[model samples]
Target: MTNAMWTHGVEWLTAATPDPRAGERAWLPGDGTVLMEAGRHWDLVSVPRQLGLLTLDILWYDPARTPGPTLVDSAAHRVGFLVPPDPAGDWSGEGVRHASRGAWVAVPPPHRTARSLEWIVPPDACTALHPPVTLRLALREAYETLAVLAPVC
Candidate 1:
């Protein structure tokens, strides 16, 4: 079975971190890491898992204050591996579990590892982050968004 085509929207804000002023945020598609200003210090967010063509974890920085309605700026960073379904595997309703429109699921990786922490994502779930449009355009948009929101240093 072929992997379904899908995409997800970028996250605008990340969960609170240990430091109240600093956090990590994503500015581009396929970006494995990001740095953001938290007051006078810079914080880093790294990809914990290998990135795949289809799946990614949402990570972004949320500032304590902003001038306008935008509380969070820039595209969210993601970390995860892709696991498109095997063409020979069954895709019917035999063992398919009901998932939300954009939920992530843990699945066996294409290659086995001690971690065994791969994820399978539905096409619709990634619509915002990885849209049906060309990746170049999507990445450009993400970068522009980041430029506008990222602080000047």
Candidate 2:
């Protein structure tokens, strides 16, 4: 990856995990690990809940492709992974699971990790969900912000 690509990668991480002052909240456990496949990037985040845990995933894909939304079902509470537009591929469905506390689930094949922890985003605080169209733009903005803030970028 070029310097620019590395910058974008850093930005992607920062955009996914910002300070509480920047509206970044601890929605999940285990922090998160980023995945890059096809042409887009994904953050498998763990969010905790009373009943169970939730994985609040976010994807950044090209807007031109306009991919469809993906639905995920977990054992505890609701698990959702937003599928961003990408020509590469879709990382949704069958990937959702419980991430509450110390329990760790095996990471399915085609994914990088052998196993990972899961969690949920606190439902009450996450109200800034934009429409798909707007989210695409926000994704871009966050990427840019990350590029500017990242040290290695």
Candidate 3:
């Protein structure tokens, strides 16, 4: 989506910030990205960049399973998927980092899609954060797909 099209999605993401107005001023224009805390509105499922991208492709291609907002940090080689809060901290995907409480994530304004950090799928008003099980299964699928594709000795 174009930067102009993401205005509403940007607002939805910014509302998660500790200081919504400050986040707007800092990242919305020329300032850079902002950090929003995890576990309040939702938690995070942090995945390796490549695998996450694979999973993203899988999810996006399937019209029945459009995931929630996803953020990618190319420099860090990390991708984070937003999921509903895990009050029990029971998410146990093989390699996923489920950030519940006391964790934060860097979120880029959607206008900066060309930047190191940007949205893979910008959030809208209608959807809920990804279900942990769905994200976990997709991640596992990505990993297995990669394993099969690798050149073997």
The lDDT leader among the candidates is 3
RMSD of each: 20.0, 17.9, 2.4
Instruction: Score candidate 2 by lDDT.
Output: 0.30
> Which portions of model 1 show Cα errors greater than 4 Å?
1-107, 110-117, 120-133
lDDT of 1 by residue, 1-153 (tens): 133221121222222123322322222323222231221211111121222121121122214311110111112223322122222322122112222223323222111111323223322222222221232232334445546777899
Q: How does each model score on TM-score?
A: 0.23, 0.23, 0.84
Give the per-residue lDDT digits (tens) of candidate 2, residues 81-131.
Answer: 333323333222232232222322222111112134231221111222224
Which 10 consecutive positions of candidate 3 have the poorest summed lDDT?
87-96
What TM-score would candidate 3 get against the native? 0.84
Better model by lDDT, 2 or 3?
3
Query: Candidate 3, residues 26-132: lDDT per residue as tens digits?
Result: 76466387778888788888888888899888777668777888988788898888988886766555566887778887777765664688777777655568877
Alpha-carbon runs more than 4 Å astray in model 2: 1-80, 83-115, 122-130
